[model samples]
Target: MGPKTYSWPVATFDPLILKQPRWILAIVVGVVITLAFVRLGFWQLDRLDERRVANTTSEARMSEPGRPREGVLGEHGQEVNEMLHRATSVEGAFRTADEFFSPGRVVSDRQGTLVATPLDLADGTVLIVVRGIVPPGTPGPPAAGFEPPSGSVALVGRIDDGEKPIPIGEHVPEDGHLASLSRVDLAYIDRWIEGDVLPITLILEEQTPPDPGGVPLRIPREELTEGSHLGYAIQWFSFAIIVAVGVAVLVYRAGTRAGPTEAFPDGASRL
Candidate 1:
């Protein structure tokens, strides 16, 4: 009845279980993962190159003088993306009462409204003219006695392709009064103006001074930056490399290990 000693069984690890077959499988998986990562990295690099080319082309086009041309109004559909920031001259009388104001356009630390007016060409077809940006909170025509150009005047502006109309709530009118128009819908404007309108819209580059309000027409500078696709691609590739390396290390260790040894009791000695 000295001390009641209890002995517990010890567990042994079998290194042979991780044999050549298992090591081979691990190497194969590791190589596959590494290849996948390398492919992803190259794909990211390709996309970066494409973006660089596009940015360079756009900047070069913007720096040159815009093209100015005159043609028959409202003849057929025309693609406007090619003429963006390019100069175009139009001779038509500005429709005063029909001027539409687009609010909430914030650019270059200045908030203002984009003014859109229908230009009645000599041939009776209408051209939508964007008369440039005016300062926010400016009193519109009726409120400040604003008066548009009288007779047919020369106009020059950048061509902007129309986009889909912004969705409105139920409280907003669908057809009647013009409120804060978020997007430019050329088809809707054509129907509203009741004529064959030009597919391209002009952003007015020059205009007369505002009537009573202190609003001045201006253009905001746009700042561009490189996107994060390259960074994401690098991360994905790095992950794949890590996975491959981890598997390789495991396989290498397994290949170099020795067989397992039996365990003995605490008091036992090697004989």
Candidate 2:
């Protein structure tokens, strides 16, 4: 038999290969990518607005005067409006004998216990007052007994809501007398007092005697982080835009590399 011959055509770039399908895909991809970037930019703008509003609300509350002492303790709505650093005054006597200790509190890089005492207000309502911090290694109940300010003392303090309880099996003291559990369970306080207790709590700021028991009252400091959300929002949107653009560029390149010759492999040549 005669030698079999095979001829393979040399590949050549055809500018006409840029057809309707390629143009369509390019337009669709470009539009989609552009839309994605625009959406992300708007999302960041929205987050910036939200953060601004939050900051304004917080500032307004902080700048406003403290709630009136007469109806403040029993009022639930007032607690939500209270901001850190806002001061409140109360006329009350501390329940020294019935004092409780909150363990595992850290202040100024030193581990300490927060002293909580039920303040019996002049009107017979009980409000939980976090008097001050006691140094670590001090026994749960000081041997000399906890001493609050002397008779009918007036106190100015910052408002605080209750805290969540520590997990079960945590190393909270079980002894009911010397120390109670880790959490300030308000319900338990109410039951113990046998009266309607205020939902709000206080961190003592100023007292009649500046130095009560030689321990100066510690006021809480507020830490604020500004523009954090706007930064995060920008990051998320930037990532989305990068992803969309990358996909579009890859699709456009692939389409451009494919020529019209492949559109029909077996059809006869048309000049």
Candidate 3:
């Protein structure tokens, strides 16, 4: 090869920028704002990905075979939080005497209440199980014809995060009627039972001695509604691009504009 040629690095920033010192401030501001918007767009996309993964995992877990209640739940409880919505089986007797009614739950478009009863395990640990839903037509107190099975029972249900606390005061359940609990919050469950209780709730899928007519089997339904995060991310990125394009147009205008003129001129030149 002839003398080794050295390729000089190309200048990325505008060379004419030094001539128009004021443009330095505009460019800096534009870059900062653009970066901020771009980062926000990426953050929203990350959130979208996380939400999608969570929903998909939950759906998959719900469909797969359930794990043993003791193995997953353990003694400390709420250990396998990532396994939410996973199906599981429990062997215990329903404590109908301390049955709780979660008010204002809707199923299949019709409004109703969820029957939450404690399942006293052999190891003395109490688990709150949401047995099923009572239809809107069913009257309160005794839940019409619905009653939990007597003696030992085996249940299959999907794992659930205990209900979020609703704004409601404590109300004692009557002798025959189920207690009107505003939500299935663990704090509320503690009020109904003594000592430590399981931190999760099971939405009844299959229960022995079926009462199909009395309490309809409430299967867990997945909410597949994709949120507007993707749209929001697009909007942010578009805004950043628009701002960048505006900066480019500004630089182009500066390059093409005529040279600066004198502020003051002689009388002859003024004419």
Candidate 4:
């Protein structure tokens, strides 16, 4: 007998197969996931733009000549965010008796505490001044010379806003002063100061009369830099593309595979 020939069914993809309920559901799910990832990428881009604008504003404000305390605070209705990082000077006497400390502060990678003291401004409005960073464990008054200078003094600092208050459990008071705080939440510190306290605080940069001992180390101005937003955006965009291509490949494979009712042999249909 002559050599026998065998016939085998060949796989073929049909676009109509994608219309089936399962494929349709898969396609819809894939599309939704892809769109969500794309939206997240754009959100990160928006964050980047905001950061850039903030950096520009900070650079411009910090470079200009320092404004007097009144000039910085006199602008009616100006929010603390708007004035942040701007250079300003104020003449006041430190109310040492009411000083408190914010622990877990870091300067040059060294753990420390921020000495927060209320300054009696010339206009009678109290201003919270973050004198500087003291050793981590130093509580109430910073041990002698590190104490806020006595009498009237002039100070130069950058404008900063108060931090949001944390749970009261972490902010217990001690002898009219807080031994430590999680942040400089002025609202909680307001109890120690008399009269109206400004909504902002100063990151003390310089004082007319320097403390010879320099117990509390001066903190450097924070450097502005774009964070991981761009990288995160790229990752999200990549995920979207991957999901799109993966879905397409899966649909093609599924459609080409054999189904219950399909055409196999030439001009013949499988039962």
Candidate 5:
């Protein structure tokens, strides 16, 4: 019979083994990546905080009683951001000739176009109003069935800021009397409008003597819910943990695979 063979177990988990230069580099890289992921997680947390504050402010502003448009604007116009979502009342006559369409607005998963019109206030200034959403494919101005009521009108609406303008090439037609605009940018619209244009847009909530046809659907108030920032933060933190675990696993495998520095028979004696 062959003599029984026995060997000592290698020290696979020795902390000293990880002191090698290669392992040190791996650890440094892993730590850097982990810290980056942690930073991303914290960044998401910060975004969550900002969102909460904004939501709170909006809710508070929206719940208050409506104020006169002039009062909201003050002697010198207030920053649009500070007044956003505040309810206000205005009286003006619709300048239907200068109307434009803002396409690609989606409501409740249904696509539609927003009818943007210039309202000539009594003071001779123009206020941009997003009246409501219309069916897709509706024509721009002087459109049949979608015409806003003629003559002076009173409006109750929430204050809103304009959107970023679509680049020249991207706007539909890109020519005289634009049929549709990519967004509700008042600064861009001011170029074509005849009078001074208000910096903010009014998202129309109520119109006196409602449109007889009711063709354009009234846009609902925006729903305020905490977004997915928390989930993203968790995901980033989980990635950091996973990277740490992966680095630990790789280090353990490297140490184990390196084998022992010395091996001895079971009965052998060491000096």
Candidate 6:
């Protein structure tokens, strides 16, 4: 028998998109990646704006002197719009038994706690006043310096809405001790508290008698400077830009089937 022969055809690149590896999938993936990054970039910008507004409000409040408490907190309840962070003077007698301590606070560059005591006002209404800061780990029923003075006392502090407390089922405050708590919720605490308490709470600033025994009154920072937010925003935008550039490069490579340029890589092309 004559020698048998076998032949195989040479392989060549096809300029047909359909034949290409997951060409449709590639386009979809590219669009998704690009859009996701774009969304993140926009989110950062929004957060940056919020931070600026908050800081401005704080600075404005700090610049002014104390306002009158009655004017800010009328009989109808706290004038919500004008009371937050408004420094004011209040006169009342301390209800020591009703005093509760908010543990975990920082003062004078040191760890401490807050004295949340009720004050019996002249109008027979009770007001929640954060007496002042005391070293943390102090048991309930505050000691001398941290306690409010007996008899009539006029003190100054910034009126603020107490923080919201943990929801009813989530938190159970320890008896004779208030620890591991989050905020000073008026509605929640009012249930167990006595007397007609004011809606807003006072951050102890100054008292007529011996000093408050607390460091000078000042705002505790709740949010970080915008500089950090700005930095993060820039990073998000950078990521988006990178994703866009990568998509462009991929599309270009896929379209040009030749070493540098040809056409879309798909089905076979006619000569």
Judging by TM-score against the true structure, name the best candidate.
4
lDDT of 1 by residue, 132-240 (tens): 5666775663113344556767776666666677667223447665444566677777656656787777766665433334334655423444577689788978888
**Candidate 4 residue-wise lDDT, 113-225, digit = tens:** 87878899877889988888888666456434587668898999999887888766454565655556788887766765676888899988889787656557777888999
Worst 10 residues of 3 by lDDT: 262-271
Query: How many backbone overlaps does candidate 3 show?
Result: 0
After superposition, candidate 1 runs with Cα above 4 Å error: 1-47, 71-77, 139-147, 167-175, 208-215, 221-226, 246-271
RMSD (CA, Å), candidate 2 to true, equals 9.3
Q: Predict model 1's lDDT versus the native.
A: 0.64
lDDT of 3 by residue, 145-259 (tens): 8877688888888888787875665566665343677777887668557646877878788888665347654745657655998999999999999999999778766665444
Q: How would you encode candidate 6's per-residue C-alpha lDDT over 1-271 as one tens digit per residue?
A: 6444433333344457545668767767877887787777678788889878877786677567876777655632546645676678888888877777666777657776666778889888888877656666665555445555677888888777888666563266557333334467777666657768778888776777744553323435344367666677778778778877887676666665434333433443424
lDDT of each: 0.64, 0.63, 0.74, 0.81, 0.84, 0.67
Cα-based TM-score, every candidate? 0.63, 0.66, 0.71, 0.86, 0.86, 0.74
- How many backbone clashes are present in model 1? 1
Task: Name the Cα RMSD for model 3.
Answer: 10.8
Cα deviation at 257, candidate 1, in Å, is: 5.4
Query: For each candidate, how many residue pairs have backbone atoms clashing (under 3 Å)?
Result: 1, 0, 0, 0, 0, 6
Lowest summed lDDT window (length 10), candidate 4: 261-270
- lDDT tens readout by residue for model 5, 139-216: 656555888888988999999888887667335354657557787877778877889998898988889867655557
Higher-lDDT candidate of 1 and 3 = 3
- For lDDT, candidate 3 versus 4, the one ahead is 4
lDDT of 2 by residue, 126-220 (tens): 88887767765556453133366657878877776667655572343344443554777665566555445787777787777543555623636
Residue pairs with backbone overlap in model 4: none
Of 3 and 6, which scores higher on TM-score? 6
